[model samples]
Target: MMNSKQVIEKIKEENISFVDFWFVDIFGELHCMGMPSYSLSEDDFNDGLEKLDASSILGFKSVNKSDMILKPDPSTFRILPPDYDPSRKNARIFCDLYEGNRAEETRFNRDSRGITAKAKGKLKEFGLTHSMWGPEIEFFVFDAINIYPSPYGATHSYGGSGYSIESKESPWAKGNASTAIDLKEGYYPSQPKDTLGGLRKDICDDLYRYFGIQVEAEHHEVATSGQSEINFKYGEMTEIADAVVTIKNVVKVKAKKRNKVATFMSKPIFGDNASAMHTHQSIWNNDTNRMYDPNDSVAQLSQEGRYYIGGLLDHASALCAITNPTTNSYKRLVPNFEAPVNVCWGLGNRSAAIRVPMYLKNREKSKRIEYRVPDPTANIYLLEAALLLAGLDGIKNKKDPGDHVEENVYKLSAEKKRELNIGSLPTSLKGALDAFQSDMKFLEDVFTKDFLDAYTELKYKEYHAFAQTPTAWEVSMYTDA
Candidate 1:
């Protein structure tokens, strides 16, 4: 970890002209406020930036109580690559928000970063020091993207909302009838068929070179039309969340430089597989992996591991409200799309919500659970914190995760699923919010009541907006009826 003195000296050595303080809204959209490098001192690094009105930020505060401080975390300090900011010598540092002018002890209740910090502290109560996470970040890159909604202040516009995306790898693109990628057979294709290979390489390089994120693998994903996945090395929960936010920003900026657009929306296309951020996680003490067991021959998952999975299944529906926060997230969770809908655990079963990967030979060091339900739209801090709380609750209550299914869960009959006491995830954002309202006791230790209330209120507004909007599909089907 970099201390204030080291950070200040590094800034002087690097001659960084400006420093950008970064923080996240409830939805994980990054917000930045930059200051000239000369304006900062050792004291500023030790204390924080001046208090600002946080009312403008979503899910933060009302106009009446808007004061908050941005306390920089020097450990997250990094120099932005030239490609990301060619106009100037720029650096960025993530921040923790605190109540107005108070000591750092008085953290803002609604600050997602503060919530993550509290979640980490809770691990110590369970005799664990770290919760490691690795996410398979997937997305799609397109040559052009068009949304047919009227711009703000427009006097005239179309009657219905619509969108169109174009990609050279797509079958429908001009002159791609012969060269287009096959529908669901786009996985692991080489040079000619995978037109986005160079783009993915550029993204991976930037992630490692500028952001210090180590790339494990990069390749074309299952879906066609420029879909890609980049695997990054796992780390502690908060640090990994920081990497996730950085990865998304780097992908978008790099794609734009190539005259392309990238999207992390769960289901951007119909009739094909959608993007997902399947997360792999495990718990650890100082030097021992708490989730692994050598004596268990079948799966080698320890009792603690079983309890964690139990917690995830117990709170699966409520977790959807945070992990898959958007209305369109449900559209991707349906059956037959490789996305998980059933709430169950299994060994190496992709159809199950939590799949225990068996490929790793080093079970003691590498054993972990891959939660397949989450998509890329989630706020990283909230998602990790909520998941940890739910798991810890299971550990506290000694919740039992039922038998691990060996068969494909999606193919199981409804009667069979019922016989096994299996349940399905919430089918929509409203369903998830409803579940969250009743099942939030697990999160009480880390997430403040006020924070959750504001989150639910903000998400309900999102659901209503999407619910009330008239889509082109609706107009087309009902126009002549």
Candidate 2:
């Protein structure tokens, strides 16, 4: 880890032309504002901060309370890859947003990054030193996209965003297509069938070389077009949130250089797999793994681990508002495509919301639960905070997650599912909002009430906007009648 002085020295030695101070909006979108190397100041970099008008950003401020400060964290410093911008040397550092102008400043309540930091600090009460998350964010790299939806009038051209795969990258191109990986069967085939193999590899290699995120694996995910994943080793909550933003940026930047568009929007394509951010969560103190148990013969999860799952299941409905926080997010959560509709935990069950991955022998350190409902569109900072808080509630209350659903819930009969008392997640943004409004204790503990209100207000506006819009599908079905 570098101090402010060390970071400044590196920038000078590296001949950096520009340094972008990075922060996140409430929606988890990365925002960068910068200055030239001549403007570098150690006092502001380390002890003090740079100022900005937070009122202009979404979910942050009113006109009267517009002021905010950004304090760059030296540890998150990284130089952009040459391919990213060969014209000028560029580097980035993540920052936290604060509201007050005084010496003792308070973090901006709506800043997602700040809320995550507070959530991590809150873990101190449990004697847990850290919580780590690994999100398997799957996305598609398309050759081009066109999104144009009309909303105000019935006669207007309606909703439909066209996504097409480039002929060279697509498996379905020739006059007589060369066995096009058949829709949902694009998992793990190398080269010929897996067209984006080389691209994903480049992304992984660059992520490690630039940002110090070691790639665990990269592979062709289950989709025909260009769906893929570049997995990385998990780290602490705040650290991983920072990495998530960097990873998405690198993928998009690198893809654009090759004349491709990388998208993380869930359910971009119809009748095929949707991109999911299935987050794996684990807790530890120092170097000891807190989820494993040597004495327990049943599933090998500690009492604390089971309770954590319990808390997650108990609050799964409300958690959706944070984790799957988009109108498109619910479109991907439907049954039959392995996108988790049932709110139950299971061992190796693809249909269950929570899955305890059966790790290899002697790999107890890797034992953790994966929450599968979230999509890449979520704000990682707020998503992690929700998961950590929900898990902590489970640990404190000793909530027991009863009877794992080992069988495929989709295959189970309605009578059997009813017997098991299994529940389904919120079906849409409206359903999720209802759940969120009903439960505020866990969410409010991290997000200030004002922030929560603003967030929901914005989300409701989004939902209503979409809800009132006319779709091409509706026109196609009813126009003839």
Candidate 3:
């Protein structure tokens, strides 16, 4: 990790023209302010910009109490690749939010990065030194997209009211569509069928060269319309969160450069596989993996691991508000698309919410649980914090996850599900928000009451707006009636 001095020196040595100070809001959207490198000082890197207005940022603060600071975290300093901006040299550093000025800064409760730090600190209280996370971030690339408005009484209408997307990867593309990928058959197609392979490689290259992210693998995913997945090596939760933000930016910018549009929406398409950010996680104590146990004849999960899973399962519905945080996310959580709809844990069962990967069984270090319900739309910092807290609660209470279901969960009858005590995840964003209302005590250690209230209020606004809107489906179904 570089210190403030080192970062300043490197900026000069590398001749970076612009340096962006970056941070995420409570809703997980990235916000940035750029400064000319010549104007940046060591104090800017150490103490941060002291007068950022928080009222303009969602879930931050009211106008009366909007004063906030953006303290740059020097370790996150990275040079942008030429692909990101060919016109000029650019770099970025992630920042932590603070309420006070440079004289005496205090952590802002609604700050995404600060919240993550608090969550990581909680691990120390449990005798765990670190928690690692690996996210299988999935997305889609399209040739073009059009977003238009539904006419309102043949008069004025709000813009961006409806949307459509196009891709050469889809069978519906206009002429020369012979190379289009068949429905749900885009997995691992070669050059002829996989038009986005070069784009993925370029994205991976930018991630490594500019951001220092170690991408493990990249390929087409299970959707025919340019759905893709890029697996990155796991790291501490906060570091991984930073990488996630970087990955999304790199993907979007690089795709745009290639005359394509990339999106991380949970369900951007219909009747096809939707994107998910299946997260693999594990706790560590010193050099040992706390999630593994060689003597366990069953799934080889340690007691701690079982309890963690128990916590996750018990609070799965509530966690959805943050992990799957979009109205469209529910559309992807449905069955038959490799998405986990049931709140259960199992060994190698993809349909279950949590799966214990057995690919490297005896390798203790590789043992981890993969949570399949989360999508890329989530704010990485908030998502990881809530997940860790839930797991920690389970560990403290010694929660039991019960027997693992090895069979296909989708095939299980209602009676069988009831017999196994398996439960269903919330079917909509509203349902998930309701669950969060009852189960939010688990997050009290890290999240403030005011922050929770603001978050829910914003989400409710979104839910209500979506519920009240008229869609093309409604127009098609009930317009004549």
Write down the TM-score of every candidate.
0.97, 0.95, 0.97
Clashes of each: 0, 0, 0
Give lDDT tens digits, candidate 1, residues 226-320: 89999999999889999999999989989999899999998888888999999999999987989899888879999999999999999999999
Regions of candidate 3 where Cα sits further than 4 Å from its true position: 101-103, 150-161
CA RMSD of each candidate after superposition: 1.9, 2.1, 1.6
lDDT of 1 at 214: 98
* Residue-by-residue lDDT tens digits, candidate 3, 141-189: 9988887755342244553256788988788887635668877888898
Tell me the lDDT of model 1 at 251. 90
| Model 1 vs. true fold: TM | 0.97
> Candidate 2: what lDDT?
0.85
Itemize residue pairs with steric clashes in candidate 1.
none
Backbone clash total, candidate 3: 0
Arranged by TM-score, best first = 3, 1, 2
TM-score of 3: 0.97
Local distance difference test values of all predictions, in order: 0.89, 0.85, 0.90
- The true-versus-predicted C-alpha distance at residue 111 of model 3, in Å, is 0.7
